[model samples]
Target: MLTPREFYVVIERDEDGYYVGEVPQLKGCYSQGDTIDELLTNIKEVIELCLEEQEESNKNLSEFVGIQKVSI
Candidate 1:
């Protein structure tokens, strides 16, 4: 069996009120949905597709450190 891997998803609500999700570890890996739950489900599928399309040997996923808020 293959080992399970975890990924960090960055989610944001767009101006149109859709929830958008993106995986920083995988370039161009993203998805959207009407609700948070739906977004999560959709993003999971997208992640799977991205993983399958990438060559395992060449896959270089970045570690998720943390997100910070900046003050102007």
Candidate 2:
């Protein structure tokens, strides 16, 4: 059995009111849906697809450090 890997996802609501989600670990891995539940489901599918594509290309996933907010 393959060990499950954890990934951090960033979600935000766009101007059109669609919930957009992206996995930072995987480049160009993103998805959108109307609701949070749907967004999560969509993002999961996107992640799976990205993983498969990455495997085909033998791409390496970048390490996620953290996010920060700065006031200027």
Candidate 3:
């Protein structure tokens, strides 16, 4: 069995008030929900789908680095 992988998600609330979540490690992986709980659930499903698709291509998942905030 494969070990569980932990992914870092960047979340934001759009102008419409929906919570949008994106996985930086997985390219083109994102999902939105009405609430945080829903968003997380949806993101999990999306990640699974992305992984299956990646299996064929054998793409490498990027390592997660810490996020930083900068002000000009």
Best by TM-score: 2
Q: Could you give candidate 2's per-residue lDDT for residues 1-72 as a string of tens digits?
A: 999989998999999999999999999999999999999999999999999999999999999999999999
Q: Per-residue lDDT for 4-71 in model 3, tens only?
A: 98999999999999999999999999999999999999999999999998998999898878899999
lDDT of 1 by residue, 25-68 (tens): 88899999999999999999999988887876577777778889
Winner by lDDT: 3
- After superposition, the stretches of candidate 2 with alpha carbons farther than 4 Å from their true spots are none
In terms of lDDT, which candidate is stronger, 1 or 3?
3
What does the lDDT come to for candidate 2? 0.95
Q: Which stretches of candidate 1 lie over 4 Å from their true place?
A: none
Q: List the residue pairs that clash in candidate 2.
A: none
Question: Candidate 2: TM-score?
Answer: 0.95
Error at 57, model 2, angstroms: 0.5
Candidate 2 vs candidate 3: the TM-score winner is 2
Per-candidate clashes come to 0, 0, 0
For all predicted structures, in order, the TM-scores are 0.87, 0.95, 0.94
Error of 2 at 69 (Å): 0.5
Global lDDT scores for all candidate models: 0.91, 0.95, 0.96
Output the TM-score of candidate 3: 0.94
